[model samples]
Target: MRITQGFTFEAAHFLPHVPETHRCRRMHGHSYRVELTLEGPVDPVTGFVVDFFDLEAAFAPLLQRLDHHCLNEVEGLENPTAELIAIWIWDRVKPAMPMLAVVKVYETAMSFAEYSGG
Candidate 1:
């Protein structure tokens, strides 16, 4: 079974590698949406792969760091593209939740990226 939990944070960033004239080169902000997925057999006794509260607790610190901050200034997120952000989030939370299977990030309603530790 697979379970997913979602979170939201607001942050600003600029893609430094983009052309100087590109709009993305100018600092912009996003109401970023993140989803963390975990996969494993559901425990018969607990009836869950992992508790939602536990997952929330494990990821709360990450949310705190990214929320309302400038992603370009964050240590591992200088560029902070949706793709890279998904991977960065995966790296940080995977250790605490070995069942973690995917990290999905949405920069906009129609634009999102997913990472599965590959």
Candidate 2:
């Protein structure tokens, strides 16, 4: 089975690598939404692949670094694009959550990127 937890944060960033004329090159903010997915067999005793609260706690420190901060300034997130953000999240989370299957970052309601540690 698979379970997904969503987290939201407000952050500002710019794609420094983008062309000078591109709008993304200018700093902007987003009400970002990130979904962390985990896959595993349900624990017979706990009846969960992993406890939701435990997952939240495990991700709390990373979340604090992202929430209300400039993504470009965050270590390892110099680009801060949704695609890169997903990859960044996958790297940080997989250590604590071996079952983590995907890291999805939503740059906007209509756009998102998913990374499966690949």
Candidate 3:
């Protein structure tokens, strides 16, 4: 079975690689939504792929670094685009949540990016 947990954080960033005329080159904030997905056979005893609470706890430290801050200043997130943020989150949380199958990041109501530990 596969399960996904959603979390949100607010952060500011700018894409320095973008053209000077591009608006994304200017710092902006987003109320970002992150979905962490895991896949595995259900544990016969616990009846869960993994405990939801444990997943939340495992994600807390990463969130602390992202929530209410300038993501561009965070290590490994100098660009902080949705695509990069998804991958960065995957890398940070995968060590603790080995079953992690996907990291989806929503940059806005209509836009999102997904990373699968690739």
Candidate 4:
């Protein structure tokens, strides 16, 4: 079984390569949603794959880094594609939670990308 936790952050981004008149070319925000999945044997003491509270704590710094900021201005995200963002977050939070199996980032209600085991 897998356990997943979700968090939300608001951030702005612009795709410079797009036409200047494109709506996404202007700095705009998305209510980004991140879902992290943990896979492995559950802890016998807590009877959970991973503690939800612990998951939230693990993601706190990440959330702070992205919340209310311009994602395009962040280092390493010059384009800020959903794929890049997923990988960026995975890199930062993976070490703290060894059980992580996948990271899914939702740019909108219908669009998202998954990064795993990298």
lDDT of 2 by residue, 18-114 (tens): 8999999999999999999999999999899999998999889989999999999999999999999998888888999999998899999999999
TM-score of each: 0.98, 0.98, 0.98, 0.90
Model 4 gets an lDDT of 0.90
Alpha carbon lDDT of each predicted model: 0.95, 0.94, 0.95, 0.90
| Tens-digit lDDT track of model 3 for 5-47 | 9999999999999999999999999999999999999999999
Worst 10 residues of 4 by lDDT: 16-25
The residue pairs found clashing in candidate 3 are: none
The superposed Cα distance between candidate 2 and the true structure at residue 108, in angstroms, equals: 0.5
Q: Which stretches of model 3 miss by more than 4 angstroms?
A: none
* Superposition-based RMSD of candidate 3 using all C-alpha atoms, in angstroms: 0.6
Off by over 4 Å in 4: 19-22
Error of 4 at 43 (Å): 1.7
Whichever of 3 and 4 has more lDDT, that candidate is 3
